[model samples]
Target chain A: MSVSSQDIPTAAISRLVIYLRILEALEAAEISRTSSSDLAERAQVTAFQVRKDLAYFGRFGTRGMGYTVPLLKRELMRVLGLNRTWNVVIMGMGRLGQAVANYPGASDYQFGYVGLFDIDPELVGREIRGLKVQHADELKGFVQTRPVDLGFLAVPPEHAQAAAQTLVSAGIRGILNFAPTMIQPRLIPGSSEVESEWKAVSVENVDFLAGMKRLAFYTLNPHLRPSELKPSELSSTELEA
Target chain B: MSVSSQDIPTAAISRLVIYLRILEALEAAEISRTSSSDLAERAQVTAFQVRKDLAYFGRFGTRGMGYTVPLLKRELMRVLGLNRTWNVVIMGMGRLGQAVANYPGASDYQFGYVGLFDIDPELVGREIRGLKVQHADELKGFVQTRPVDLGFLAVPPEHAQAAAQTLVSAGIRGILNFAPTMIQPRLIPGSSEVESEWKAVSVENVDFLAGMKRLAFYTLNPHLRPSELKPSELSSTELEA
Candidate 1:
C-alpha cells in the first residue's frame, strides 16, 4: 500500500527509529523473530501502539507468527533512510564539535564525516578523525566538489545563526544543531520566499539542558511519570520530539 | 487552582521550557507582556496550543492584556522546578563531559555542578571549571557531605551502567545520561521493588545519534516535515520527546 508522508505522525517515525534499534539488538542476540507483544514490551509501549505504529508503513507481521527480525530491520532502515551513507560536515570544531566528530555511533549508521569547518586559524589546519579542519571560507567551495548532506552546528550561541547561514549557503540539506541557541535562517538570501533554494533546510536540535530540565521535573514528580520506565522505554522523551 | 503533574504531557513540559526561554528573551528586551498569538509566533506553535498548555497550570493570561512576561516566566520556572538550585555532579570526565561542564547554559537554570568524578588516574586530580575531579570511589562519601541532586553520566557505553550505579549508591536523585547506550537501573540493589530507595532515580537520555537519524528522515522527506520550521519552531523534535 502507498503511504503519504503527511499521513504519518512524526512520533511514529521516532518510534520506528526505536523499533529499528530494538530489532538490531534482537538480531545481534541471534533472535530471528519477534512478536508485536515482544516489540511492545521492549519498546515500553502497549502492544496495540506498536501494531499501530508499524501499520502506518504497511503490514509486516503474520497473524499467528510474529515478524522476522532481519526482514523488519531492513524495512525500517530503508524507511528511515539509514540504508545509504549520509555525508556530514561539522561546523565549529570546538570541544563539542571534536567530541561529535569522534562519536562512534555516527559511523555505525553510515553518517560519514566528510568535512570539518572552523574559524580559528589554529584549528583550521588540524586534522581530526582523519578529516582536516577547513576554514569556514572553504565551505561553499567544498560542497560544490563534495556531497555533504548535513551540517552539525556546535558553535557558541552568538555565532550559531551566522554559522548556519554559511551551511545553508553551502547547500547543505539539513542540520543537526547542538548549539544551545536558536538559529533563524532568515539572514540567508531568499530564505523567506517559497521559491528559495535554502527554504527547505531542516534542522534538528540536540539540547542537553532540555533533558536536564525534564529530569528535574520527573524527579520532583515521579508519580506523574507517564509509565514505569523500562530501559527500552526510558527514552520516551526522545520519541516526543 | 491546584494542578497534578500526571495531567501534564511531557511534551507540554518541554514546550514550557521553550516558552520560558522565550519569556526570558522578551524580559531581556524589556517587553513586559505578550499575547498568546505573539508567544505562539515566537514558539512556532499554534496560539491555541500555547493557551491549552498554559491552561494546565492555571489561568495566567488576562483577556486582552495577555500574559505579563516576567510573571509568566516566574510561573514557568516554578512549574518546571527550576526556581531552586539543583546540585549536580559530572560522573565521567571525558571530552563530552568536559564540554557539558563548561556549557554556560546550565547555570542559567540554577543547575549547579558541585562535583566531578572519574576513574582515570590521570584525570582524577585535575581541576575543570574550578571543580576538581575526584575518584569514582569517592562519590558515596562525597554525597553524604554535599548533597547532589543529579548525575551527568558521560561514561562510555560499556561502563555507563557501573558509573550510574556508583551515582545511585551515592544517592543521586536523577541522571542526565549522555552515554550512547541505555543504562538499566535493574543492577542497583532493590531497584525493582516499589519500596526500594534507588527505585526513584530518574534518567533522561541525550542521544546525539537519535537527532541525526531524525534529521536524515526529514532531509529525505522534507514534504513530511511536521511543519514549516521557523527559528523558534525548528526544534519541534525537541518537544516531541
Candidate 2:
C-alpha cells in the first residue's frame, strides 16, 4: 500500500512523531500498555486531541484498554518512515553544520551524515569525526550519484537561498535549513500546484531573539514582568475555541 | 514600576519576540501601518490571537485602523527587553557550543557571546572566532564578575544538568540548553522563589526525533500517503455548534 501525501495533517504527523518518542521512552522503562490520557500527559497534549489525531491515521486503540504501548509505537514508527535510514548531507562545514553533524540527536534518529560540503579550501580536506569534508562544487554530482534524501543548510544567511536552490536542483526532496533567511523559492515550471509546501526549516532565531526581546520588554515596562508575558491557560482555551 | 512574574505566558513571551522580528523586517521594508490580520498572515497565526496577545501587554492597536507597525514594533522591542545588550556564555566548547557561539542569529539579536567554557584542557586554552575558551572551573567567578543573564549549554547530555546548576548557582537567570538530556535540578533551599525561578529550558530534540518518526511512519505504512494529510477546514456548522 503506497501512501500519498494527503492522508494526514502535517501537525498530526509531527504529533505522531512525539507519540513515538514517548512510546519509546515507555518501552525503555519496561512499560507496555498506555491509555490515551497517559500518552497525552506524557506528550503534553489533550487525550481528545490524541484520539482524534490517531483516528485520522487509523484505528489503533481498544475502547477499554486504550493502546498497547509497543504496538502503537511500532505503528507510529511505520507511519513516520523511520524504519529506514535517511542519508543526510551537510552543506557548509561551518560551526552550525559541524554541530548538526555531531549532534547525538541526529544519530539517535538514524540520520546518517554521510558527507560534508564546503567552499573553504582549508576545511575541504579536513575530516570531522571521520566524515571527510568535500568541496561545495561537488554537491550536484554528489546528490545525483549518492541520492541523498535530506540536506541540512548551515551556511551564512546570505548564502542560504543559493544553497537551498542547489539542493532543490540536485533532486533533494527534504531540507532542514538552519540559515536565518526567508526562502520563498518558486517551483519549477510545469509542476503541479501543491499548496505551498513549506519545508521544515527549524529556525533557531526565535528563542534567541525572543529571549532578548523578553528581557528588553521587561526592562522598559518595569511593571510588565516575564511571567505575565506567557500565554495563560484561559488564552489557550480561547484560541482553541 | 516593578513587574511581577504572573502576568504573561512564556509561550506568548516567545511570540512577542517573533512579533518583534517581523516588525523589524516591516520597518526595514518601510511599511508603516499593519492590521492584526496582516501581522497574523505574515506570522502564520490568527488575527484574534494576535490581538489577544498584544492586549495582554498593552493596547497598541486601534479599532478599524489596525496597529501602527512602527509604534507596535517599538513597544514590542521595549517590552521584550531587547533595548539592553545581553552577555552570554556558552558552556561545553564542543562542536555544538562552537556552533552556537558563532550563530549569526544570536549576534543579530544583540546576544554577545562573551566566553566559552569547557573542562577539556586542550579546548580551554583555545580561541574560536575571537571568543576565548575559558576553563569551566572559572564559570562561577566569571558569572559573578560579568553578571551574565543567559547561559547556552551545548555540552553532552550527561553534563547538561551540572553545567546548568553551575550557571544557576552563579546567579544567571535565563538558560538556553541544547543538550538532549532532561535537566531537572533540585532548587536550592532558602532561595527566593522568584529569583531562583525555574529556568526556561527549551528542548531542541523535538524536530529531529519527530521528523524522523514521521518519515519512518510514512515509509512503513505505504497506504498512508503524504497528499492525504491536509487538515480539514472547520465548517461554519462546526463553528456554530
Q: Give a tens-digit lDDT track for model 2, residues A1-241.
A: 2345455655576677668777776677667778777776555567887898787767788787677778988777655666568898888888888877777876765788877998989889899979889998888888877758777788887888777767666666566666665443321222333223333222212133343455445434433433321212211211110
- Reference-based lDDT, residue B92, model 2: 92
lDDT of 2 at A95: 84
Lowest lDDT 10-residue stretch of candidate 2 chain A: A232-241
Give the TM-scores of the predictions, in the order they appear. 0.86, 0.77
- The digit string of per-residue lDDT tens for model 1 on B1-241 reads 2467445766787788889878876787677778787778666677889999898888887877788778988988887789899999998898888888877588988999999999999899999999899999999999999778899998887888788878876788799989887665533334345226556778788889888888898899887776543444322221110
The TM-score that candidate 1 achieves is: 0.86
- Per-residue CA lDDT of model 1 for A142-226, tens digit only, reads 9999788999998988888789878977888799999887554433334345226566888888988789888888888876665
For model 2 chain B, the run of ten residues with the poorest summed lDDT: B232-241
Candidate 2: Cα lDDT at B135? 92
Q: How displaced is residue A13 in candidate 1, in Å?
A: 2.5
